[model samples]
Target: MTRMRIEGLLAAFPKLIGTGKQHTYVETENVRYVYQPMEALYLLLITNKQSNILEDLDTLRILSKLVPEYSYYFEESICKCAFDLILISLGHKENVTVAQVKQYCEMESHEEKLHRQMREDKIREAKDEMKRKANEIDKNKAIHVIYRL
Candidate 1:
C-alpha cells in the first residue's frame, strides 16, 4: 500500500511541477520526499518534514553514488538489491564517505545476496512440501472412494 502511494506520488510530480523543472525534493505538511533520477527510474527517500534538508541531500547523494556500483541496470529488482546495500552502508551514521560506502556495500552485498537466496530456498521448499502433502491427500481420497464403490 505504501509502495503504491509512493509510486503514485512520484508519477504525479512531473505533472505538478511542469516537465522542464527539475525537483530534488518535495515537502508536504507531514513528510519530505527526496528523490534522485536515474536513467530509467527515480530513487525516492521519505523523511519527516522537520528533518534537515541538507542532511537529506547528503544521504541522497551517497545513495545515488552507490547505484552505479551495484548494477548498471535500472530495473526494479536491481534497484531493490541496490537499495538494500545503501541501507546497510548508511547504518547509524549521519555522514559517510564514498570509500566507506563502497567498502560497506561490497562487504554487505555478498551476505545480503546469500541471505536472499536462503530465504527463497526456504519458500520453495515449503511450496514443494505443501504440493506433496496435497497430492498425498488427493490420492488417499481417491483410494477411499474406490473402496466405497
Candidate 2:
C-alpha cells in the first residue's frame, strides 16, 4: 500500500510539473538528493506504526529552515515542493498527531498545530485554485463556441 501511494505520486508528478512546480529531483555534481520524506511522513501518519519520526522530522525542519542560506546553490521552489509533499502526505492520513509532528520537527505545540492548520488551509486553497482554473477554461471554450455563431 505504501509503494502504491509512492507510485501514484510519481505517476501524477509530470502533470504537476512545470510552472513553478519543482522538487523530487536535485543534483550537485557528485552529490544528489531526492526530497522524499515518505518514511518520515509515513511514521507521522500511521499512528500505530512506530518509528522515530519526531527525531527525523526535527532534523528535516532544521535542514529546511537553513535552506534559505544556500539559495544560490539550491532552488527554493524544489525544497518547498518536497516539504509540501511531506506535509500533504501526512495530512492525508488521519492518524497524524500534533505531538508527533511537533516532536519530530522540534517545534512547540503551537507551531505544530499551526503547521497542521496550514496544511488544511493549503488544501482549501488548492481546491479553490483548481476550480478557478476550470472555470476559466470553460469560459474560454464558451467564447470560442460563440464566435462561430
Q: Tell me the RMSD of model 2 versus the true structure.
A: 18.9
TM-score (all chains, Cα) for each model: 0.54, 0.29
Please report, as a residue range, the 10-residue window in candidate 2 with the lowest summed lDDT.
Answer: 40-49
RMSD (Cα, Å) for all candidates, in order, is 6.2, 18.9
How would you encode candidate 1's per-residue C-alpha lDDT over 26-141 as one tens digit per residue?
77766677887777776677777877888888888877887666676657657567444435334344566888767764575677889999999999999999999999999999
Q: Return the lDDT, model 2, position 95.
A: 47
State the displacement of the C-alpha of residue 102, model 1, in Å, after optimal TM-score superposition: 2.1
- On TM-score, the leading prediction is 1
The backbone clash count of each candidate, in order, is 0, 2
Clashes of 1: 0
